[model samples]
Target: MSKPLRALDEAALVLFSGGQDSATCLAWALARFGRVETLGFDYGQRHAVELDCRETLREGLRKQNPLWKERLGMDHTLALGALGDISETALTRNAEITMEKDGLPNTFVPGRNIIFLTFAAALAARRGIRHIVTGVCETDYSGYPDCRDDTIKAVQVALNLGMDSRYVLHTPLMWIDKAETWKLAEELGGPALVSLINQESHTCYLGDRGTMHPWGHGCGECPACALRRAGWEEYVAEKARA
Candidate 1:
Protein backbone atom coordinates (compact mmCIF):
# COMPACT_ATOMS: atom_id res chain seq x y z
CA MET A 1 0.00 0.00 0.00
CA SER A 2 3.05 2.28 0.11
CA LYS A 3 2.93 2.68 -3.64
CA PRO A 4 1.11 5.48 -5.32
CA LEU A 5 -2.46 4.96 -6.52
CA ARG A 6 -3.16 3.96 -10.06
CA ALA A 7 -4.77 6.35 -12.51
CA LEU A 8 -8.38 7.48 -12.04
CA ASP A 9 -9.49 5.48 -15.04
CA GLU A 10 -8.91 2.25 -13.11
CA ALA A 11 -12.23 1.36 -11.52
CA ALA A 12 -12.60 -0.91 -8.49
CA LEU A 13 -15.26 -2.95 -6.78
CA VAL A 14 -15.03 -3.48 -3.04
CA LEU A 15 -15.95 -6.57 -1.04
CA PHE A 16 -17.86 -4.62 1.55
CA SER A 17 -19.44 -6.26 4.59
CA GLY A 18 -20.34 -3.04 6.44
CA GLY A 19 -18.02 -4.20 9.18
CA GLN A 20 -15.10 -2.15 10.42
CA ASP A 21 -12.53 -3.88 8.23
CA SER A 22 -14.67 -3.79 5.10
CA ALA A 23 -15.66 -0.17 5.67
CA THR A 24 -12.00 0.77 5.95
CA CYS A 25 -11.30 -1.08 2.72
CA LEU A 26 -14.16 0.72 1.04
CA ALA A 27 -12.71 4.05 2.09
CA TRP A 28 -9.30 2.93 0.90
CA ALA A 29 -10.72 2.15 -2.52
CA LEU A 30 -12.64 5.41 -2.72
CA ALA A 31 -9.51 7.36 -1.86
CA ARG A 32 -7.45 5.64 -4.54
CA PHE A 33 -9.77 4.69 -7.39
CA GLY A 34 -12.01 6.78 -9.59
CA ARG A 35 -15.16 4.65 -9.49
CA VAL A 36 -15.81 2.43 -6.51
CA GLU A 37 -18.76 0.09 -6.15
CA THR A 38 -19.55 -2.04 -3.13
CA LEU A 39 -20.72 -5.65 -3.07
CA GLY A 40 -21.97 -7.36 0.09
CA PHE A 41 -23.01 -10.89 0.90
CA ASP A 42 -26.02 -12.09 2.86
CA TYR A 43 -24.75 -15.50 3.81
CA GLY A 44 -27.22 -15.77 6.66
CA GLN A 45 -24.69 -14.61 9.25
CA ARG A 46 -26.12 -14.52 12.75
CA HIS A 47 -24.83 -10.99 13.00
CA ALA A 48 -27.12 -9.82 10.24
CA VAL A 49 -26.89 -6.33 11.72
CA GLU A 50 -23.99 -5.78 9.28
CA LEU A 51 -26.43 -5.97 6.36
CA ASP A 52 -28.54 -3.27 7.93
CA CYS A 53 -25.47 -1.12 8.60
CA ARG A 54 -24.16 -1.16 5.03
CA GLU A 55 -26.21 1.71 3.66
CA THR A 56 -25.52 3.88 6.66
CA LEU A 57 -21.76 3.37 6.38
CA ARG A 58 -21.87 3.88 2.63
CA GLU A 59 -23.75 7.13 2.93
CA GLY A 60 -21.50 8.35 5.70
CA LEU A 61 -18.35 7.49 3.78
CA ARG A 62 -19.48 9.24 0.61
CA LYS A 63 -20.29 12.39 2.56
CA GLN A 64 -16.95 12.50 4.37
CA ASN A 65 -15.34 14.10 1.35
CA PRO A 66 -16.54 15.63 -1.89
CA LEU A 67 -14.26 13.43 -3.91
CA TRP A 68 -15.53 10.36 -2.10
CA LYS A 69 -19.07 11.46 -2.81
CA GLU A 70 -18.22 11.68 -6.47
CA ARG A 71 -16.35 8.37 -6.69
CA LEU A 72 -18.72 6.14 -4.75
CA GLY A 73 -20.92 4.21 -7.15
CA MET A 74 -23.74 1.67 -7.05
CA ASP A 75 -24.02 -0.94 -4.34
CA HIS A 76 -24.92 -4.61 -4.68
CA THR A 77 -26.03 -7.34 -2.29
CA LEU A 78 -26.21 -11.05 -3.05
CA ALA A 79 -28.16 -13.59 -1.06
CA LEU A 80 -25.99 -16.62 -0.43
CA GLY A 81 -28.26 -18.37 1.97
CA ALA A 82 -26.85 -21.66 0.75
CA LEU A 83 -23.51 -20.85 2.37
CA GLY A 84 -25.28 -20.51 5.67
CA ASP A 85 -27.55 -23.49 5.10
CA ILE A 86 -24.44 -25.60 4.81
CA SER A 87 -22.23 -23.76 7.31
CA GLU A 88 -22.66 -24.88 10.91
CA THR A 89 -20.19 -22.34 12.30
CA ALA A 90 -20.98 -19.83 15.01
CA LEU A 91 -21.32 -16.98 12.53
CA THR A 92 -23.93 -18.80 10.44
CA ARG A 93 -25.58 -20.56 13.37
CA ASN A 94 -26.80 -19.59 16.82
CA ALA A 95 -24.11 -21.70 18.42
CA GLU A 96 -21.75 -20.15 20.93
CA ILE A 97 -18.49 -18.82 19.57
CA THR A 98 -15.58 -20.95 20.63
CA MET A 99 -12.11 -22.02 19.61
CA GLU A 100 -11.62 -25.34 17.90
CA LYS A 101 -9.07 -27.86 19.12
CA ASP A 102 -7.22 -27.61 15.85
CA GLY A 103 -6.38 -23.90 16.53
CA LEU A 104 -8.94 -22.38 14.16
CA PRO A 105 -12.00 -20.65 15.58
CA ASN A 106 -15.51 -21.96 15.07
CA THR A 107 -16.28 -18.68 13.39
CA PHE A 108 -14.26 -19.82 10.37
CA VAL A 109 -16.71 -20.40 7.57
CA PRO A 110 -14.92 -22.50 4.98
CA GLY A 111 -14.75 -21.06 1.45
CA ARG A 112 -16.73 -17.97 2.39
CA ASN A 113 -14.05 -15.58 1.12
CA ILE A 114 -13.50 -17.66 -1.99
CA ILE A 115 -17.18 -17.60 -2.76
CA PHE A 116 -17.31 -13.86 -2.10
CA LEU A 117 -14.38 -13.14 -4.42
CA THR A 118 -15.75 -15.42 -7.15
CA PHE A 119 -19.09 -13.63 -7.09
CA ALA A 120 -17.37 -10.26 -6.84
CA ALA A 121 -15.20 -11.05 -9.86
CA ALA A 122 -18.28 -11.98 -11.85
CA LEU A 123 -19.91 -8.73 -10.84
CA ALA A 124 -16.80 -6.75 -11.65
CA ALA A 125 -16.62 -8.37 -15.06
CA ARG A 126 -20.21 -7.41 -15.76
CA ARG A 127 -19.45 -3.87 -14.61
CA GLY A 128 -16.21 -3.72 -16.62
CA ILE A 129 -14.07 -3.06 -13.55
CA ARG A 130 -10.49 -4.37 -13.32
CA HIS A 131 -9.65 -3.98 -9.64
CA ILE A 132 -11.30 -5.52 -6.57
CA VAL A 133 -10.58 -4.50 -2.98
CA THR A 134 -11.04 -6.62 0.12
CA GLY A 135 -10.31 -6.28 3.86
CA VAL A 136 -9.09 -9.77 4.62
CA CYS A 137 -5.93 -9.62 6.78
CA GLU A 138 -3.73 -12.10 8.58
CA THR A 139 -1.87 -9.63 10.80
CA ASP A 140 -4.90 -9.37 13.07
CA TYR A 141 -7.46 -12.07 12.37
CA SER A 142 -9.19 -15.23 13.56
CA GLY A 143 -6.76 -17.59 11.82
CA TYR A 144 -9.02 -18.13 8.85
CA PRO A 145 -7.01 -19.88 6.19
CA ASP A 146 -8.75 -18.01 3.41
CA CYS A 147 -7.70 -14.66 4.86
CA ARG A 148 -4.04 -15.34 4.34
CA ASP A 149 -2.12 -13.25 1.80
CA ASP A 150 -0.97 -16.29 -0.14
CA THR A 151 -4.55 -17.50 -0.35
CA ILE A 152 -5.68 -14.19 -1.80
CA LYS A 153 -2.83 -14.19 -4.30
CA ALA A 154 -3.74 -17.69 -5.37
CA VAL A 155 -7.38 -16.72 -5.62
CA GLN A 156 -6.48 -13.73 -7.77
CA VAL A 157 -4.52 -15.91 -10.18
CA ALA A 158 -7.29 -18.49 -10.26
CA LEU A 159 -9.88 -15.79 -10.95
CA ASN A 160 -7.95 -14.17 -13.79
CA LEU A 161 -7.23 -17.50 -15.54
CA GLY A 162 -10.67 -19.02 -15.01
CA MET A 163 -12.61 -15.97 -16.17
CA ASP A 164 -10.08 -14.79 -18.74
CA SER A 165 -10.31 -11.37 -17.15
CA ARG A 166 -7.37 -9.28 -16.03
CA TYR A 167 -8.86 -8.50 -12.64
CA VAL A 168 -6.43 -7.38 -9.92
CA LEU A 169 -7.63 -8.14 -6.41
CA HIS A 170 -6.34 -5.52 -4.01
CA THR A 171 -5.62 -6.26 -0.35
CA PRO A 172 -4.49 -3.02 1.28
CA LEU A 173 -4.88 -4.33 4.80
CA MET A 174 -3.24 -7.67 4.21
CA TRP A 175 -0.04 -6.82 6.06
CA ILE A 176 -1.33 -4.19 8.45
CA ASP A 177 -2.64 -4.81 11.95
CA LYS A 178 -5.91 -3.50 13.36
CA ALA A 179 -4.23 -0.55 15.04
CA GLU A 180 -2.86 0.54 11.69
CA THR A 181 -6.26 0.05 10.12
CA TRP A 182 -7.77 2.62 12.50
CA LYS A 183 -4.95 5.01 11.68
CA LEU A 184 -5.59 4.37 7.98
CA ALA A 185 -9.16 5.61 8.21
CA GLU A 186 -7.92 8.82 9.78
CA GLU A 187 -5.18 9.25 7.21
CA LEU A 188 -7.75 8.79 4.45
CA GLY A 189 -10.52 11.01 5.86
CA GLY A 190 -9.58 12.20 9.36
CA PRO A 191 -11.69 12.06 12.51
CA ALA A 192 -15.00 12.33 10.71
CA LEU A 193 -14.27 9.09 8.91
CA VAL A 194 -13.20 7.48 12.17
CA SER A 195 -16.44 8.53 13.84
CA LEU A 196 -18.44 7.20 10.92
CA ILE A 197 -16.81 3.80 11.29
CA ASN A 198 -17.20 3.75 15.08
CA GLN A 199 -20.87 4.57 14.89
CA GLU A 200 -21.99 2.92 11.66
CA SER A 201 -19.86 -0.16 10.99
CA HIS A 202 -20.90 -3.47 12.61
CA THR A 203 -18.36 -6.14 13.61
CA CYS A 204 -19.61 -8.04 16.63
CA TYR A 205 -20.11 -11.70 15.95
CA LEU A 206 -22.91 -11.78 18.52
CA GLY A 207 -24.87 -8.99 16.79
CA ASP A 208 -25.19 -7.16 20.09
CA ARG A 209 -25.67 -3.57 19.01
CA GLY A 210 -27.58 -2.81 22.18
CA THR A 211 -24.35 -2.92 24.18
CA MET A 212 -21.99 -0.07 23.37
CA HIS A 213 -18.25 -0.18 24.04
CA PRO A 214 -15.80 2.74 23.79
CA TRP A 215 -14.42 1.41 20.53
CA GLY A 216 -17.91 0.65 19.23
CA HIS A 217 -20.97 -1.53 19.96
CA GLY A 218 -20.44 -5.17 20.77
CA CYS A 219 -20.67 -7.77 23.55
CA GLY A 220 -16.95 -6.96 24.18
CA GLU A 221 -16.07 -10.62 24.66
CA CYS A 222 -16.23 -12.14 21.23
CA PRO A 223 -13.00 -12.44 19.28
CA ALA A 224 -14.07 -9.78 16.81
CA CYS A 225 -14.94 -7.31 19.55
CA ALA A 226 -11.76 -8.07 21.45
CA LEU A 227 -9.58 -7.46 18.42
CA ARG A 228 -11.29 -4.19 17.56
CA ARG A 229 -11.18 -3.02 21.17
CA ALA A 230 -7.50 -3.76 21.51
CA GLY A 231 -6.72 -2.01 18.27
CA TRP A 232 -8.72 1.07 19.16
CA GLU A 233 -7.05 1.26 22.53
CA GLU A 234 -3.61 1.02 21.03
CA TYR A 235 -4.45 3.57 18.38
CA VAL A 236 -5.75 6.01 20.99
CA ALA A 237 -2.69 5.47 23.12
CA GLU A 238 -0.40 6.19 20.19
CA LYS A 239 -2.36 9.32 19.35
CA ALA A 240 -2.01 10.54 22.93
CA ARG A 241 1.74 9.94 22.79
CA ALA A 242 1.98 12.03 19.65
Candidate 2:
Protein backbone atom coordinates (compact mmCIF):
# COMPACT_ATOMS: atom_id res chain seq x y z
CA MET A 1 0.00 0.00 0.00
CA SER A 2 1.17 3.53 -0.72
CA LYS A 3 1.90 5.83 2.18
CA PRO A 4 -0.37 8.86 2.68
CA LEU A 5 1.11 12.14 1.48
CA ARG A 6 3.02 13.93 4.19
CA ALA A 7 1.55 17.21 5.28
CA LEU A 8 3.76 20.27 5.78
CA ASP A 9 2.49 20.56 9.39
CA GLU A 10 2.61 24.35 9.17
CA ALA A 11 -0.30 26.69 8.61
CA ALA A 12 0.07 29.51 6.08
CA LEU A 13 -1.89 32.52 4.96
CA VAL A 14 -1.73 33.43 1.27
CA LEU A 15 -2.15 37.02 0.12
CA PHE A 16 -4.12 35.95 -2.90
CA SER A 17 -5.39 38.43 -5.49
CA GLY A 18 -6.50 36.07 -8.26
CA GLY A 19 -3.60 37.06 -10.54
CA GLN A 20 -1.51 34.42 -12.26
CA ASP A 21 1.43 34.73 -9.92
CA SER A 22 -0.75 34.77 -6.83
CA ALA A 23 -2.76 31.83 -8.09
CA THR A 24 0.40 29.87 -8.70
CA CYS A 25 1.55 30.72 -5.21
CA LEU A 26 -1.80 29.52 -3.93
CA ALA A 27 -1.26 26.17 -5.58
CA TRP A 28 2.21 25.99 -4.09
CA ALA A 29 0.88 26.78 -0.63
CA LEU A 30 -1.77 24.09 -0.89
CA ALA A 31 0.92 21.59 -1.73
CA ARG A 32 3.47 22.68 0.84
CA PHE A 33 1.49 23.67 3.93
CA GLY A 34 -0.59 21.46 6.18
CA ARG A 35 -3.19 24.20 6.53
CA VAL A 36 -3.68 27.24 4.30
CA GLU A 37 -6.06 30.16 4.01
CA THR A 38 -6.39 32.83 1.32
CA LEU A 39 -7.11 36.55 1.69
CA GLY A 40 -8.13 38.95 -1.11
CA PHE A 41 -8.22 42.72 -0.83
CA ASP A 42 -10.46 45.12 -2.67
CA TYR A 43 -8.39 48.27 -2.51
CA GLY A 44 -10.32 49.74 -5.37
CA GLN A 45 -8.06 48.40 -8.11
CA ARG A 46 -8.95 49.53 -11.60
CA HIS A 47 -9.20 45.93 -12.65
CA ALA A 48 -12.07 44.99 -10.38
CA VAL A 49 -12.95 42.25 -12.81
CA GLU A 50 -10.16 40.16 -11.35
CA LEU A 51 -12.16 39.72 -8.15
CA ASP A 52 -14.73 37.76 -10.08
CA CYS A 53 -11.99 35.51 -11.35
CA ARG A 54 -10.81 35.11 -7.76
CA GLU A 55 -14.19 33.84 -6.68
CA THR A 56 -14.41 31.49 -9.63
CA LEU A 57 -10.94 30.15 -9.04
CA ARG A 58 -11.60 29.55 -5.38
CA GLU A 59 -14.74 27.55 -6.08
CA GLY A 60 -13.11 25.56 -8.86
CA LEU A 61 -10.09 24.80 -6.70
CA ARG A 62 -12.33 23.56 -3.92
CA LYS A 63 -14.18 21.35 -6.33
CA GLN A 64 -11.03 19.87 -7.81
CA ASN A 65 -9.13 19.33 -4.55
CA PRO A 66 -11.72 18.80 -1.91
CA LEU A 67 -9.31 17.62 0.76
CA TRP A 68 -6.77 20.31 0.02
CA LYS A 69 -9.47 22.94 -0.10
CA GLU A 70 -10.93 21.76 3.17
CA ARG A 71 -7.54 21.87 4.76
CA LEU A 72 -6.81 25.36 3.44
CA GLY A 73 -10.14 26.90 4.54
CA MET A 74 -10.38 29.80 2.10
CA ASP A 75 -11.61 33.20 3.29
CA HIS A 76 -12.07 36.27 1.06
CA THR A 77 -12.42 39.80 2.35
CA LEU A 78 -12.56 43.41 1.13
CA ALA A 79 -10.97 46.45 2.71
CA LEU A 80 -12.12 49.95 1.81
CA GLY A 81 -9.04 51.85 0.76
CA ALA A 82 -9.12 54.61 -1.83
CA LEU A 83 -6.57 52.94 -4.07
CA GLY A 84 -8.05 54.51 -7.19
CA ASP A 85 -8.66 57.93 -5.67
CA ILE A 86 -5.62 58.91 -3.65
CA SER A 87 -2.86 57.09 -5.47
CA GLU A 88 -1.17 58.53 -8.58
CA THR A 89 -0.24 55.07 -9.84
CA ALA A 90 -1.66 53.81 -13.10
CA LEU A 91 -3.28 50.87 -11.36
CA THR A 92 -5.16 53.31 -9.17
CA ARG A 93 -5.33 56.62 -10.97
CA ASN A 94 -6.16 57.66 -14.53
CA ALA A 95 -2.62 57.32 -15.86
CA GLU A 96 -2.16 54.62 -18.49
CA ILE A 97 -0.60 51.34 -17.33
CA THR A 98 2.42 51.56 -19.57
CA MET A 99 6.04 50.50 -19.27
CA GLU A 100 8.25 52.28 -16.80
CA LYS A 101 10.45 54.80 -18.59
CA ASP A 102 11.74 56.57 -15.52
CA GLY A 103 11.78 54.87 -12.13
CA LEU A 104 8.84 52.78 -10.96
CA PRO A 105 5.94 52.64 -13.39
CA ASN A 106 2.79 54.66 -12.84
CA THR A 107 1.01 51.44 -11.99
CA PHE A 108 3.18 51.02 -8.94
CA VAL A 109 0.63 51.31 -6.22
CA PRO A 110 2.64 52.86 -3.47
CA GLY A 111 2.42 50.70 -0.31
CA ARG A 112 -0.20 48.45 -1.85
CA ASN A 113 1.69 45.21 -1.32
CA ILE A 114 2.89 46.44 2.00
CA ILE A 115 -0.66 47.03 3.08
CA PHE A 116 -1.73 43.62 1.88
CA LEU A 117 1.16 41.84 3.56
CA THR A 118 0.64 43.77 6.75
CA PHE A 119 -2.96 42.66 6.87
CA ALA A 120 -2.00 39.13 6.01
CA ALA A 121 0.55 39.09 8.79
CA ALA A 122 -1.98 40.32 11.33
CA LEU A 123 -4.42 37.71 10.15
CA ALA A 124 -1.79 35.01 10.36
CA ALA A 125 -0.83 35.97 13.88
CA ARG A 126 -4.42 35.83 14.92
CA ARG A 127 -4.79 32.38 13.43
CA GLY A 128 -1.54 31.13 14.99
CA ILE A 129 0.11 30.70 11.62
CA ARG A 130 3.76 31.49 11.23
CA HIS A 131 3.97 31.56 7.44
CA ILE A 132 2.67 34.14 5.01
CA VAL A 133 2.87 33.46 1.28
CA THR A 134 2.84 36.00 -1.55
CA GLY A 135 3.57 35.91 -5.28
CA VAL A 136 5.56 39.09 -5.80
CA CYS A 137 8.30 38.41 -8.33
CA GLU A 138 11.08 40.80 -9.19
CA THR A 139 11.69 39.01 -12.47
CA ASP A 140 9.40 39.70 -15.44
CA TYR A 141 7.49 42.04 -13.17
CA SER A 142 6.26 45.56 -13.64
CA GLY A 143 8.78 48.10 -12.42
CA TYR A 144 7.00 48.43 -9.10
CA PRO A 145 9.24 49.57 -6.28
CA ASP A 146 7.10 47.53 -3.92
CA CYS A 147 7.74 44.28 -5.81
CA ARG A 148 11.49 44.22 -5.21
CA ASP A 149 13.27 41.85 -2.84
CA ASP A 150 14.43 44.65 -0.62
CA THR A 151 10.90 45.98 -0.28
CA ILE A 152 9.56 42.56 0.63
CA LYS A 153 12.25 42.03 3.23
CA ALA A 154 11.55 45.40 4.75
CA VAL A 155 7.85 44.61 4.88
CA GLN A 156 8.57 41.28 6.51
CA VAL A 157 10.54 42.95 9.22
CA ALA A 158 7.88 45.57 9.73
CA LEU A 159 5.14 42.99 9.95
CA ASN A 160 7.06 40.95 12.49
CA LEU A 161 7.81 43.99 14.60
CA GLY A 162 4.30 45.36 14.35
CA MET A 163 2.66 42.13 15.40
CA ASP A 164 5.40 41.02 17.78
CA SER A 165 5.32 37.60 16.20
CA ARG A 166 7.77 35.41 14.36
CA TYR A 167 6.28 35.11 10.89
CA VAL A 168 8.09 34.13 7.72
CA LEU A 169 7.08 35.69 4.41
CA HIS A 170 7.34 33.20 1.56
CA THR A 171 7.82 34.45 -1.97
CA PRO A 172 7.87 31.26 -4.04
CA LEU A 173 8.18 33.33 -7.19
CA MET A 174 10.74 35.84 -5.94
CA TRP A 175 13.94 34.67 -7.64
CA ILE A 176 12.25 33.17 -10.70
CA ASP A 177 11.29 34.88 -13.92
CA LYS A 178 7.88 34.27 -15.46
CA ALA A 179 9.10 31.48 -17.76
CA GLU A 180 10.67 29.75 -14.80
CA THR A 181 7.57 30.44 -12.76
CA TRP A 182 5.52 28.52 -15.32
CA LYS A 183 8.00 25.68 -15.08
CA LEU A 184 7.78 25.63 -11.29
CA ALA A 185 4.02 25.38 -11.50
CA GLU A 186 4.36 22.35 -13.72
CA GLU A 187 6.87 20.80 -11.38
CA LEU A 188 4.52 21.21 -8.47
CA GLY A 189 1.47 19.71 -10.22
CA GLY A 190 1.60 19.60 -14.00
CA PRO A 191 -1.45 20.80 -15.96
CA ALA A 192 -3.42 21.83 -12.88
CA LEU A 193 -1.36 24.99 -12.48
CA VAL A 194 -1.17 25.60 -16.23
CA SER A 195 -4.90 25.28 -16.76
CA LEU A 196 -5.77 27.45 -13.78
CA ILE A 197 -3.40 30.17 -14.94
CA ASN A 198 -4.55 30.01 -18.55
CA GLN A 199 -8.31 30.01 -18.06
CA GLU A 200 -9.00 31.34 -14.57
CA SER A 201 -6.29 33.77 -13.51
CA HIS A 202 -6.46 37.42 -14.60
CA THR A 203 -3.32 39.38 -15.44
CA CYS A 204 -4.83 42.11 -17.58
CA TYR A 205 -5.46 45.42 -15.94
CA LEU A 206 -7.71 46.33 -18.86
CA GLY A 207 -9.77 43.13 -18.28
CA ASP A 208 -9.58 41.80 -21.85
CA ARG A 209 -10.86 38.22 -22.00
CA GLY A 210 -11.46 37.82 -25.72
CA THR A 211 -7.88 36.88 -26.56
CA MET A 212 -6.10 33.69 -25.51
CA HIS A 213 -2.81 35.56 -25.73
CA PRO A 214 -0.93 32.89 -23.70
CA TRP A 215 0.42 35.37 -21.15
CA GLY A 216 -3.13 36.19 -20.14
CA HIS A 217 -5.02 39.26 -21.43
CA GLY A 218 -3.81 42.84 -21.26
CA CYS A 219 -3.82 45.65 -23.82
CA GLY A 220 -0.92 43.81 -25.56
CA GLU A 221 0.82 47.19 -25.76
CA CYS A 222 1.49 48.04 -22.14
CA PRO A 223 4.56 47.15 -20.09
CA ALA A 224 2.71 44.29 -18.38
CA CYS A 225 1.74 42.97 -21.79
CA ALA A 226 5.31 43.12 -23.09
CA LEU A 227 6.74 41.25 -20.11
CA ARG A 228 3.97 38.67 -20.20
CA ARG A 229 4.38 38.22 -23.96
CA ALA A 230 8.10 37.76 -23.57
CA GLY A 231 7.59 35.16 -20.86
CA TRP A 232 5.04 33.27 -22.92
CA GLU A 233 7.36 33.33 -25.91
CA GLU A 234 10.16 31.91 -23.80
CA TYR A 235 7.92 29.20 -22.38
CA VAL A 236 6.71 28.18 -25.86
CA ALA A 237 10.20 28.27 -27.33
CA GLU A 238 11.57 26.13 -24.52
CA LYS A 239 8.74 23.63 -24.87
CA ALA A 240 9.31 23.34 -28.63
CA ARG A 241 13.04 22.80 -28.07
CA ALA A 242 12.34 20.10 -25.49
**What are the lDDT scores of the predictions, listed in order?**
0.92, 0.77
Total colliding residue pairs, candidate 2 = 1
Candidate 1, which segments miss by more than 4 Å at Cα? none
RMSD of 2: 3.8
Evaluated against the true structure, the overall lDDT of model 2 is 0.77
Worst 10 residues of 2 by lDDT: 1-10
Clashing pairs in 1: none
TM-score of 1: 0.98
Question: Could you tell me the lDDT of residue 90 within candidate 2?
Answer: 69
On TM-score, the candidate that comes out on top is: 1
lDDT value, residue 143 of candidate 2:
66
TM-score of each: 0.98, 0.89
